[model samples]
Target: MPPSLPFLLDRTDLHLAELHAARLDGDLVGVGDRFSPADIAGTVDLRGARELRALSLLPRLPVGLVVERRTAAWLHGAWAAPPGPLELCVRSDHRVRVVPDVAWSVRQAVLRPDELILVRGVLSTTPLRTALDLLRLPPDDRYDGRHRSAVITLLLMQTSGRERAAAALHRSPHLPHKQRALDRLAALSLR
Candidate 1:
């Protein structure tokens, strides 16, 4: 098994002695209040610790909101760039408001148990579902459905099998953007 990465914050010791110990051992460096790999100092650049930090904070987030869309893709390491803000999803029955730097999208239809997964110990949409959602996003400059087609296709192909991804889109007939996802999937499959 690979060695576990250092904790984003030392929870056990309130004073952060573990972080200090790591600093003494030359294993970690401090940047303001956060810590990063020792080689680079002055900033907390969490290149390898991103998943650990996200997973560590999962239990602390509000209930019923699973990470989704671009945030999920970034957590899955399928996206090249870091997401602008946290994207979370909740059922329409739940009244969640967008917070500063966090985007909360509500789903009219409830997500099935299988449609979500514990990725890196954090609840997030399954690979197939994430891809379909990406295809369903509005046509905006940042990630219009068309612009993300290639990334979504590759994400599905790598994280979930292409066959399974296609099947998921087929099964979700109620999705408002189901046809669009299907069309995108078809175009990608032909490549």
Candidate 2:
């Protein structure tokens, strides 16, 4: 028989009470019998716990965490991963919120989950989104050519964006250089 999965618990301080309340309300879903302390503590709030429980209740499939530009940079070697738990960007109220793993702290942005995807175990922003986000950053946040090329290549391989990519570049408010990149990407796709 397969080894039994351990029980997980909701231990995150901000979500503990909320998780407990959700459990009482029957709103939390999960492999209830398999909750471990680590699972409970990792959540940032009751809603997060509810979401986790819902995810856990699904047929257990390996799903990578979704990430954004900064997190992608850390995962891709442009920057070092922080010592503590990593944060992820989630959409809410027509804005993005960066929620820390242990707290309720969040920073708002005009981003959405549709702009991200999973790549090689890391959640990375979609190529177009990455490029757009990068364009908004100062020179200090720019990636080297190697990383930029890699991001473009992966995005092309993963999405059907021959036209959308071009349009995104054309409409970008940040990176004027994107037109050249878009032309190059389009040419490469035709080959």
lDDT of each: 0.60, 0.45
Best by TM-score: 1
The whole-model C-alpha lDDT of candidate 1 against the native structure comes to 0.60
Q: What's the residue-level lDDT of 44 in candidate 1?
A: 33
TM-score of each: 0.61, 0.38
Model 2 per-residue lDDT tens digits across residues 73-159: 433323333212333444445433332346222333445567765543344565556545543444554545544554454455435
Candidate 1 ranges beyond 4 A from true positions: 1-5, 9-50, 56-60, 92-109, 141-160, 189-191
Q: Name model 2 segments beyond 4 Å from true.
A: 2-66, 70-107, 112-127, 159-163, 172-191
Task: Please give the clash total of every predicted structure, in order.
Answer: 0, 15
Which predicted model would earn the best lDDT?
1
